[model samples]
Target: MSRFEEELKRDKFVCSECSRCKKIVWPPSNYCNKCLNETTWREISRKGKLVEYSYNKGECFGIVEFESQIRIVGTVKGSERPDVGQIMNLEKCDYDGDEIFIFSSTVQRNGSQNS
Candidate 1:
């Protein structure tokens, strides 16, 4: 398994924090792209918001942003259109013996009012 994928399966959502600038790097890497400095792994929340999305040929993909501004492009699992700021949950998915990450919409607040 790739390092990032392996880490995701073990650690849930993670980001590489640059020791210098403290920039959160998504798609975790060994080195920080911003400062070329060594990065330390930081665990981020599994739930985030869907910022953008697209669907084609029954395939869905979108960008999700976590609490720390950690964003990643992942396959969205549901049919609902992704709206900006829509809450989503990221989780590990097993496919073809490989672990993949996917996002799904979380339950929204029911606005039903008692009459």
Candidate 2:
């Protein structure tokens, strides 16, 4: 399995960063997409901003942007309605043939309610 998938199986969110250019490589690669330099794996922050969301069959799903760049789609978990630009916290992550990410609403750093 790829390193990314392996880490996901362990519930650790990680991505590649360019060793030379200090750039975060999305889609996690061994080499940087920009400079083609070697990449190092690094854990990602759990908090992110909700970019968009939708409900399918009463289940909430959203696209969250992390570190201002890494965007991922995941299931939104919580009873409260989620809003765009709300802070989201990664609640769970796993891999079972397919990647799985679960997130929930969170308060902003300024102590403001997000959801």
Off by over 4 Å in 1: 93-99, 108-115
How good is model 1 by TM-score? 0.71
Best by lDDT: 2
Tens digits of per-residue lDDT, candidate 2, 15-97, equal 99999998889999988999999999999999999999999999999999999988999999987789899889999999999
Runs with alpha carbons beyond 4 Å of true place in candidate 2: 108-115
CA RMSD (A), model 1: 4.2
Q: For residues 84-114, what per-residue lDDT tens digits would candidate 1 score against the true structure?
A: 7877888654334554668887765487432
The 10-residue segment with the lowest total lDDT in model 1: 91-100
Among all candidates shown, the one with the greatest TM-score: 2
lDDT of 1: 0.74
What lDDT would each prediction earn against the true structure? 0.74, 0.92
Name the lDDT value of residue 23 in candidate 1: 82
